[model samples]
Target chain A: MAQKKNIKNRATSKPSSLVWIMLILLIMGEFFLYAWSRVQCTRMGYEITREENKYKNQMNMRNNLQIELSRLKSPKRISLIAKTRLGLIRPAPKQTVIIR
Target chain B: MKFDNHKQISRRAAIIGIMFAGLFIMIGIRVIFLQTVQGPWLSKKAANQYEKSVIIRGKRGIIFDAAHREMAVSIQATSLAAYPGRIKNKNEAARKLSNILKIRFKNLRRKLETGRSFVWLKRQATPRQVQAVKALNLKGIGFIPEFNRFYPNKTLGAQVLGFSGIDGRGLEGLEFYYNAYLKGSERKIRVLTDALGRQFDTGQTNANGLGGNNIILTIDGNIQYITETALEEAAKKYNAESGIAIVMAPATGAILAMAHYPFFNPNAFNSFSRDRWRNRSITDSFEPGSTMKIFSAAAALDSGICDPNTIFYCENGEYRIGRNIIHDTKPHGWLSVQQIIKVSSNIGTVKVAEKVGGRSLYNLFKKFGFGNKTGVDCPGESTGSLSFYNKWSNIDKGTISFGQGVSVSALQLTSAAAAIANDGILMKPYLVQAITDQNGRLIQNFSPQKIHQVISARTARDLKRIMETVMTEGGTGVLAALEGYTVCGKTGTAQKVSTHGGYSKDKYIASFLGFAPAKKPEIVILVILDEPKKEHYGGIVAGPAFKKIAHQTLQYLNFTPLRQKKHQRVLAENEVSG
Candidate 1:
């Protein structure tokens, strides 16, 4: 009876030690994932900030170019160019046709 | 010996224990005081050291025409600045910068030598100048992006657009009127810094939040250009002091164009005087000569006082009213109301006003939107002087009938005429068509609003026919007649009020108010020329300009000419018969 009791105690001790080892491994894996994700998030934050600035600068540049185009296409400037450089003149009243 | 040693050691232990208790009590008191008394203050100080704040100016809104063409735009420009503390060789820096920026060398050197940590070298530097400065790459020099207001059309609609100062504050015109909506809000961004005062990256946030809303005006760019070119020519040709031309959609009271002579470029507004910047269409009032007859006729006809054929003897061109004799440009007898308006007879108009009486006439003028604000979406509109009927003398009544004693702004006169063209329903004039956000989403839309019905449809129709006669062969405004379209118009040649209190014989204001396609009018135009030389008559000076603007506007609007429509109808009839 004494020998049987000692064998059961040893058997329970072996499984309990394996369970403890698995728990320790799982915890280590979680910690490693958390640290790696934090590093990636920080790097991406810098990248997004730099990209946002580039986008803003590009938008401003496009707006400036559009303004330049509008200035060039202004009616007064067009008329001046037409009259002086292109030597164009307005048509007489009869020259224009009216379609009903 | 052992007993004496024990007593000495016990005494030493007691002394050290007392000293340790005192130190613990002092440390506890200090910790409590620091945690409670100075906590808030010290935390704020620490935050100030570790945080960085940057002020980003909001971008101003752009102004557009009806067709979404840019009238005024804001462009990003670089402003040059300096850190005076970091600047070395201040004299050299100033000399080099002044040459590039065209600033005074001594003044710039003095600014750079100041004790201030930062100083503005130039606000809104040109791209060329910015590039030149950047090439120098001088120490302590910095460049910051700023928005600068730019008018693409230069002087095309200077008075309407107004201008913004270097600091982006609206100074005049629509810019001043809609300043609250046009000027943008400022933003402050706070960043977290580490222990050594280095900022940590905050993920991409919209750098430009909500900016000021943009405005789209009711003005058509092409129509405005046409009107401006024509008015400029008329002013230059006649050698007039100044001139104004207004084109309005009679039905909706939408002012398609409002132009004034002697225009100035908004980009260089400082070089022009204050007078040149005034929008004379609404800001300036003048005695509208015979243009008042049209309103007087409406009052008489609407009140059942007279018919189109009611006859009145002209007194052979002279009429005496309360110690004053009013003279006509020419003598006429037995003239009907229709004929009177065709000739613009002063005696005939006075007699008609007498029949309508002063009370009715005053009410008529008030109802026509004179002597009051037209409530146009423009700044500095004048409420023209209209004395009460009780205050009118006999001479005042007679002269007011012929548009001498009463004064009116060009906008009021044109709007009133537009009411008549719109079958007597007065519409409040508006310029801004819509307000939009930075992303081009519509925030608010302004539609046409009818102020009130000023006259009956029957009365407006009768007046249109009578005014049509005034543009016919024998009328004073014959020059205003269009070949392919029917025109209803009135002419006015008022002697300008002299500075000394009487009418000036040499100076006259020549004006014409008219609308085309008399049966169903689309547009009403008003042209006024001040102190036109050689010819003082409205028919000669302003009548032809009225014709040109009307014809061009009708063509631009694609209104089918009367002949073309009639011919098309005939062809359709023949096709059906075959």
Candidate 2:
């Protein structure tokens, strides 16, 4: 009878310790996952910030280039280039032809 | 022995338990203290590490011409700043920056030696200079983005568009006029930063409606260029002191071109004198001279006192009224009203003015927008001096009739001439056609506003017919005639008011005020040259410029020439027959 009682107590104690181990493992896994996700969020934030800066720089470059294009396409400059470089002149009123 | 061992073990256990309980109590108290006392302070300190509230400014507004061509723009430019205390090798850094920035080493060293937390090394540095400095990788050096105003057209319409200051505030011209609307707003935003002190994109950057509203002007860039070129050529050819030219759409009073010479680039406005910064067409007034004869004739016709054929004695080129002799350019016999204007006879105009009487002429001048602001959307518009008719002396009547005693601005003259072209209805002149937001959403749209009818349509037609004779042979404005287009114009040569309280002998303001396709005028142009040296006659000095501007502008506007229209009609008829 004494031997049987001792075996039954051992069996109950094994399940309780096993359950405690599993609970602790689950809690630790959740904690690590939360920490890892925070780190990834910070990394993505840095990346987004870098991309935004790049976008702003590109926009500025586009604006500058547009301004340069406008300057190049200035009527005065074009007229000068046409006259001096291309050997062009404004047509006389009589030389002009209107289709409509 | 066994009982004594048990008692000792129990005692040790009690001591260990008490020690652990006391440690737990201390930890609990510390937690409470931190949560209650240091919580707010710690949170703030933590926030300071990773978050900051900063003020970001929007970009200044852009200025576009009628065709949406950028006249003025603001571009992103970088400025260099330094933290004086943080620089490790001040002399080396300053030397490197001096070469790239074109600054003196000593001056840069002095600036870096200052015990300031922050100092500006250069504002609005060129991109090449910025890149060169960046390559140096000097410590304690940082860059800040700022807006710098740029005029791509340079001197094309400088006096009209004006310029902004380094601080992005408009200082002159339309820039100054619409400063409030052109300057961007400021916003305070919270930004998140990383451990390395770099900002993270919070997506709130574009949330603020920060950019200033853009202004669209009625000015045509091509026409403005043509006008400026013509005015510059005329000024150079005549050796004139200065010149101003204005082009207006007769039907709407939209200012197509306001050109002035010698030209000054608004980009480097500071390098020029303050006098060159002024839009003299609106701000300066000069006597209209013979151009005023048109109005005097209009007054006479409108008042029913004289018809186009009414004959007036010219007094043989010189007439005396109260000891003041009014002389025509040449001797003239009795000429009709139209003949007087065609020849621009001052004596004949004076006689016509006498018939129209003083009060009637004064009312007519006032009706023509003389002595009043044209209400143009420009700064510092001068109200040309016009005294009441009751204050005129006998000589004043004669001189005023010949456009000597009266003064008018180029803008006012153009606007008044436009009235005649628009069939006697005066329209308010305007520069800014519309204001739009950054996204091009319309904020305001300006339209042509009619002031009132200054004369009957019949009177305007009669006046137009008489004015046309001025462009024909034997007319003062013969040079102003265009091929295949009827032109009605008047020439003006006024003796400038001298500093000694009388008219100067050597100085003259030669001017031409006219429009093309006289039967249905399309554009009204006024050209004035102050103190031309080569030629003083208004017909010779200003007429060619008027013709050039009119010809180029009308062609650009796609107005079919009369001969071209006829040829096209013949071609269409031939096609139909085939």
lDDT of each candidate versus the true structure: 0.89, 0.92
Tens-digit lDDT track of model 2 for A1-98:
99999999999999999999999999999999999999998888788878877888898899899999999989999999999999998766776676
Residue clash pairs of candidate 1: none
Clashing pairs in 2: none
Winning model by DockQ: 2
lDDT tens digits, residue span B1-578, model 2 = 99999999999999999999989999899988988999899889999888998778899999999999999999998999999988999999988999999999999999999989899999999999999988988778989888999999999899999899998999999999999989999889889987777888788766248999999999999999999999999999999999999999989999999999999988888899999999999999889899999999999999999999999999888898886777777999999999999999989988998999999999989998999999998889999999999999988988898898888999999999999999999999999999999888999999999999999999999999998999888999888888867788999999999999999999999999999889889999999999999899999999999999999998888787777778878989999998
Candidate 1 chain B weakest ten by summed lDDT: B196-205
Query: Model 1 segments beyond 4 Å from truth?
Result: A1-43, A81-100, B1-50, B192-201, B574-578
What would you estimate as the lDDT of candidate 2?
A: 0.92
**Model 2 lDDT at residue B58:** 92
Interface root-mean-square deviation (Å) of every model: 2.4, 1.1
